[model samples]
Target: MSCVQTFADYGFRALGIGERALPKTDITLCEQVVLIGSGMFWNIYFALLALLLGFVAASLVAFARNSTRAILWRPAAIFIFILRGSPLFLQFFLIYETFVLLPKVGFDLNLGFVDITVETRWLTRAWLGALIVLFLNTTAYTAQIFYGALRSVPKGEIEAALAMGMTPNQINRRIIWPTMLRLAWPSYTNEAIFLFHATALVFFSSFPAWQQKGDALYYASYFADKTFNPFVPYPIIAVFFIAFTLLIILIFGFFQRRLNRHL
Candidate 1:
């Protein structure tokens, strides 16, 4: 097939928009490239969602871990330890099995004012269940980075804020928080890249790809399996991921610059 036609067919294969069946025989280079590139849609989706949502959870956990109160610190510390200590591969399996054991009909939520049904069957799918695992894992990992930065946020600066008659909330919001983020920016950037790379594990682990709509690595593996040629497919994925990671760094660098502007 011609290059354009090859792309036209497999370009959206990963999204299930075209090419219901992948190339079984005579897999061409264009097919591998296009299919694997298309699969990046899932990778970007998983990474973006996990990082954005995980940061909120991580920041809260970081604050809790840094808190002087044992009530808050202990639980945060324990949660971070459990997640950071365990392998993500095992976490995926454990979480998937736990979801499997839950009632397929889902659980009920009664808020007195309202009631909600939480679906559990969907948790077995990679899109949701693997996402939850990745989210929690990234939160725990990033929380430690933020907590360390929080600790190093210069007590003198905080005291200066207090001396200025600033309220605790004001100091935290206007001063401490920004400083913590500035200090943590480099590590935070690394965490974002790490989480993006980890998205490759989603299909490989407990969560099965519902309709062969897996991520970049998944399609790359599929092509490799069919062609019995790891060289083209694997390197294509490497190049894609490297380009994606560099873009991430550039975006994070923009934020890092903003954070350090006042310094």
Candidate 2:
């Protein structure tokens, strides 16, 4: 097929449109680009949502770990240890199995005024199941970074706040939190990049790619498998990833600069 023809066939393949099965032997360059690019949608989706949710969860975990009370710090420390100590690949498997063991029917939620059912079945799908894994994985990693950065926050600042008769909660809100984030921004930037790279593994792990709608690496590997040519598709995946990584760095770097402006 000509380049134009190949593009036409695979252009919408990623979206579950156009030719459904993907190209087999003698895959054209356009097919590789369009199909793989389509798959990139999943990568971006996973990275963005995971990072956003993870940042919030990590912030809470950081505070909990830093809390003086054993009630707060111990659980935070254990959660971080388990997630960080175990390989993410293994965690993916573990979480997927645990979810599978959940009642196939939805779980019931009781809010004093209303009862709602949350579906457990959705947890089996890669989009939601794999996302939850990445969310928690990045949360644990980012929390550690924030916790380390928290140590660098000035003790005098908190002391001064206390001297001024400020409550601990106020000190945390008005002083510690911002400083911790400012100090942690650089490290957190690295965590974000790593999480994006990890998105490629979502499909390869316990979560099966429903409808073959996987991430960039998944589709790239698919084409490589069919053509027995890793040289082309894999490089393509790397390039796409590099581009996204640079974009991430630029964004986070901007925040890093703003955070450090007072320095």
Candidate 3:
């Protein structure tokens, strides 16, 4: 088939939106590129949502850990230590197993006013389950980054804020948070890149890709196995990722520039 036809056929195969059967024989370069590109959608999906959610959670955790109160900081310290210390692959396996062991029939939450039936089955799926793992993992790593940045925030700045008659809330919202973000952002950008690359682990982990709808590495592996050639498909995957990584750097670099504009 022509490259255009190949693109049309496999462009969205990863989403189960296009051709159902993967190319078994005579898989061309166009087919590999298109299908692998299609699978990239999932990688982007997992990375974007995980980073967005993780950022907020990390910020809160950072604040908790930075607090002088032992009650607040102890649990946060333990959480960061556990997640940052453990291997991400093992975390994925353990979390998936934990989800699988939950009652499949679902459970009821007895809220004061009403009962809410919470389903457990969905947590076993890659979309949600792997997402949770990535979210928590990134949160732990990023919280540490933010916490370190929080510590590095100049004490003189805090004193200056106090001198300006700023309330604690105002001081945090105005002086502390922005400075923390500015200091933490460069490191966070690297974390974001790592997280996006890490999304390739979803299908390889215990979390199965429902149907054939897997990530770029999933489809790349398929082509490599079929053709008995690791070269073509894997490089295609690398190229696609490299391009996207550059895009990420550009986007994050824009925000970095904005944050440092005052300097």
Candidate 4:
């Protein structure tokens, strides 16, 4: 079968889609390509979900860091510094260890007459654990970008908004937030691209792949080990990642235009 056909058969099979078992022996280059491509799906999922969720948290952090009160400002500033200053690789390792140490039975909460058990074991897995790490990591990076943008917002805009009798929250929502996003878009684009590439480190960190299911780099590493040929699979993954990175740029570029529409 062709690579595409094989992918059709085993695409999400990692997640139990079509095939139950991955091909073992006589693995052709086509199989490698198809399987690695399939694995990229998870990478894309993590990056997109983390970025989308991180944006809101980042905005909140950015605003808090810029607050006049020292209480809000200090904690937010510390969070941004700690996450941004340390390597993301270390963060992943630390978070995974922390998650693993949590009780496998999960945590329980009693609210009035209702009792809820919150699962903690799943946080040790790559899907949820690594995602939480990536989410917090990206939030820190994006918050710093947004904080800088918030500082650089033109003084006249604030003055104009205040003159119009806008409330502090109204001024921020209408005038401040939009401009901050616009100003930060380019740098934020770069952060997002790097963050996607960083997802490769997930499997290598404390999180296990569970079975053979893994992201592109995980599979590419497997092929490299089996064939003793980093030359083929690794480069193929690089090209795929570069193409994926370009797609991210294009998508963000469209938003950049939309954000700057009034300007």
Candidate 5:
């Protein structure tokens, strides 16, 4: 088939939207490129959602870790310790197996007006299960970065805010939080890059891709296994990841400039 036709056929195969069967025989360069490019959508999806949700959770955890109360800080510290201490690949396997062991019927919630049954079966799928792992892992990592930045916020600025008769809330909102973000952003940018690159791990994890809808690495592996030539397909994966990583840098760099614009 022509390249354009190949693209039309397999362009979105990774999403379960296109052809049911991947090109099994007589695979062409066009087929590999198009299918692999299509598979990148999952990597982007995992990274984008994880980073967005993880950022909010990390911010909250950072504040908790910074709190003087042991009740707040201790749990936060332990959470960060556990997540950061463990290997992500192991976390994926454990979480997936745990989810599998849960009762298939899932938990039922009772309210005066009605009852709701939350499903557990969905947790075995990569879309939701792998996502939860990524979210928690990044949250632990990013929370530490933010906590350090929070600690590094200049004491002089706090004193100035106090002298200005700013309330604690006002000081935090105006002086502390903004400065923490600013100080943390450079390192956070690195974390974001790492998280994006880490999305590739989802394919290898215990979370199963439904209907053969896998990520870029998944398709690359498929092509390599079929063709028995690692040189071609594996490099394609690297090239695609490198290009996407650069795009991530450009996007994050724009925000980095904005954060440091005053300096």
Candidate 6:
């Protein structure tokens, strides 16, 4: 069967869709390609959402780190240091354990006139927990990128804005931020590609892959175990990853062009 038909038979089978059982004795190259490509769907989902949301948070943290007050600057500095200094692999393990210890029934909040219960157990699972870790991790890395760009913003640009009676916020919004993003685009692009590759570490960390459904790396590992041939499935996965990385570069290259349009 063609890869498309193989996917049709088993794509969502990871989530119990068309096939009740995965391939056993007769696993073929086509099946490996289709299933691994299907798993890439989840990897893209996680990376895209985390990067989009984390970019805003990172910019704010970068701004706070550059603030005049010691109170604002100190915490931001320490947060960036702690996150960047430690191994992300360790962070994933620690966070998963911490989330697992929380009350299964969740915590209750008492407003003046109302009570609310927030569920915390779902965080112990791979999906939510891994997403949270990746989000915070990328935010810290991107914040440092933004911070460096913030420092490199031309002093004359700010002075000119002030001379024109531009308020502080207006100067930042209109002049400083855009330029910083433009200057930081190349390094930021590298960070983004690395973060997507890092999603492979999720299953290997403390978070459990519920129901055997997992990312591309997880399935690649499974096939390697069954067939005892690292050559076929793993190389197929690497090609998929290479294609995915190229797609990211293409998308971000378009943004880089827009950022540098006037230059």
- TM-scores, all candidates, are 0.94, 0.91, 0.95, 0.93, 0.94, 0.93
**Residue-level lDDT tens digits of model 5 in 1-263:** 79998888898898898789987899889899999999999999999999999999999999999999999999999999999999999999999999999888867889878998778898988999999999999999999999999999999999999999999999988999899999998889889889988899998878777788999999999999999989888888899999988998899889888878989
Point out where model 5 deviates above 4 Å: 106-118
List pairs with backbone clashes in candidate 1: none
Question: Which candidate's lDDT is highest?
Answer: 3
lDDT value for candidate 4? 0.89
User: Model 3, 74-152: lDDT tens per residue?
Assistant: 9999999999999999999999999998888868899989999878898998889999999999999999999999999
Candidate 2, residues 81-193, lDDT tens digits: the string is 99999999998999999989988897789999999998998898888899999999999999999999898899999999999999988998889989999888888889999
Candidate 6 achieves a global lDDT of 0.88
User: By TM-score, how accurate is candidate 3?
Assistant: 0.95
Scored against the true structure, residue 259 in model 4 reaches a CA lDDT of 90
Residue-by-residue lDDT tens digits, candidate 1, 1-263:
89899888888877788778888998888888899999999899989999999999998999999999999999999999999999999999999999999878967899999898878888998888989999999999999999999999999999999999999999988988889999999999999999999999999887887778888988998888888889999999999999999999999999999988876
lDDT, model 4, position 240: 88
lDDT value, candidate 3, whole model:
0.94
Question: On a 0 to 100 scale, what is the lDDT of residue 162 in model 4?
Answer: 100
Full-model lDDT for every candidate: 0.92, 0.89, 0.94, 0.89, 0.92, 0.88
Q: How does candidate 4 fare on TM-score?
A: 0.93
lDDT, candidate 1, equals: 0.92
- List runs of model 1 lying over 4 Å from the truth: 106-118
